[model samples]
Target: MKNMVYGAILALQFLTRFPLPVNCSMDHNTLKWALRFYPFAGLAIGGTLYLIYNLLNGLLPLYMLTLILLTLWVFLSGGLHLDGVMDVADAVGSNGSTEKKIEILKDSRVGSFAVLSVIFLLLWKSVLLYAVLDSSENELFIIAIPMMARFQALLQLFVFHPFQNKGMAHYWKQHLSMRDVIIAACWVLPFAITQVTLIILFSLQICFSFIFGKWAVRQFQGVNGDTVGASIEGAELWNLAVLYSLFLFGIV
Candidate 1:
């Protein structure tokens, strides 16, 4: 129980920019166990955005609030996943040898492909969120999307071997006995079962992760930290698109 609580705090610290009041140990053992709390960390981030939306919904124009929410989302995550999107975009756009692509992914310099991808992704996400906000007053979409997205991320972490540094993945596979991932899924499964839409989303997330995982393996022969980050951002976009489509058809 104590480790689970520390794991949750460690997850938030690693996953977001939120200021925490207490300090905790960050050893590899703690971090590997902390993987179970990633989805809840996402929920905390999304829940904060939901709270802000309620507080400012009427005071600010919908468009303004939409931008504010988007901005806050980026700030909260410290653009961690966005960095992944940029790196992977640059790598895939390079279309070079596997070694070359991996090298490019590790490069800190941004490329034209990185710039274009981030612009397109953020633009589409903003447009989608604006539509969802205007069409419905539901808080579940915002709160649930991030939670599911992080579960999607956990899928990457749990399922793939690291293409570069293999330490974390190696330790997790060795020590946790895979129950840690089950615990993470347990955090999400209850909420996913509450809605048929969520169940569909969960299934889709699994399918997408497998497909993406294969592609990553074929491309670099395995996954990297940036690639994991790419999966997280991509999952969020998928969630937003699915939700918006459901809303457009008056299904959710």
Candidate 2:
């Protein structure tokens, strides 16, 4: 019980900018068990977004609401996953050797590719959020997208080899276990039970994660923290797109 509490705190601290009630040690075992709480972190993020949406839904214009939501989203996560997206973009655009690409991923300096990718990603998410705002099923989406994205990250941790023997991804992989994945999957049950469509969408997201994982391995020889971040951001974007498409087609 104590470990679970510490693990949840560690997961929240790692995943979000939320203030912790108390400080926790960064022991390797605690960090490893924290992987199981990744979905809970996502749930926290989504719940906050949902609360903000309701608070501002009628007070602000759709575009403005979306802008604020996007800002809050970034603020909440400290742009962690988006940073991954940019790093991956820079690495991929470099067109260099695997070693060179890995070097780019490690570089702190942002490049043109990173800038462009971030812009497009924010724009895409903004548009999708705007569209979904008026849908009746928006709340479900709000609560599920982040959970699914984080779950995808967990899936990647289980399925892919870490590119390096150090860094956050390596540490997570070292501690990660099949039980962690199973527990994470259990977190999705409530959302899945509420709607069969969610189950199908989650299945698709899982499939995409595996496909993306294989591609990451082929390109980088294995996954890293950057790829995990990229996967989270990509998964969220994919989930939003799918939800919006279903909304448009009257399928949701």
Best by lDDT: 2
What RMSD value applies to candidate 2? 1.4
Model 2: weakest 10-residue lDDT segment is 132-141
lDDT (tens digit, per residue) of candidate 1 on 1-252: 667678888889878888987687766567766788888888898999999999998999999999999999999999999999999999999989999998998899999999999999999999988987888655666877788888777777677777766544444434443677788888778778887777777788788888887888898888777787788888888877887787788776
Q: Estimate each model's TM-score.
A: 0.92, 0.95
Alpha-carbon runs more than 4 Å astray in model 1: 27-29, 167-177
Evaluated at residue 118, the lDDT of candidate 1 is: 99
Q: What is the C-alpha lDDT of each candidate?
A: 0.82, 0.87
Model 1 lDDT on a 0 to 1 scale:
0.82
Leading candidate by TM-score: 2
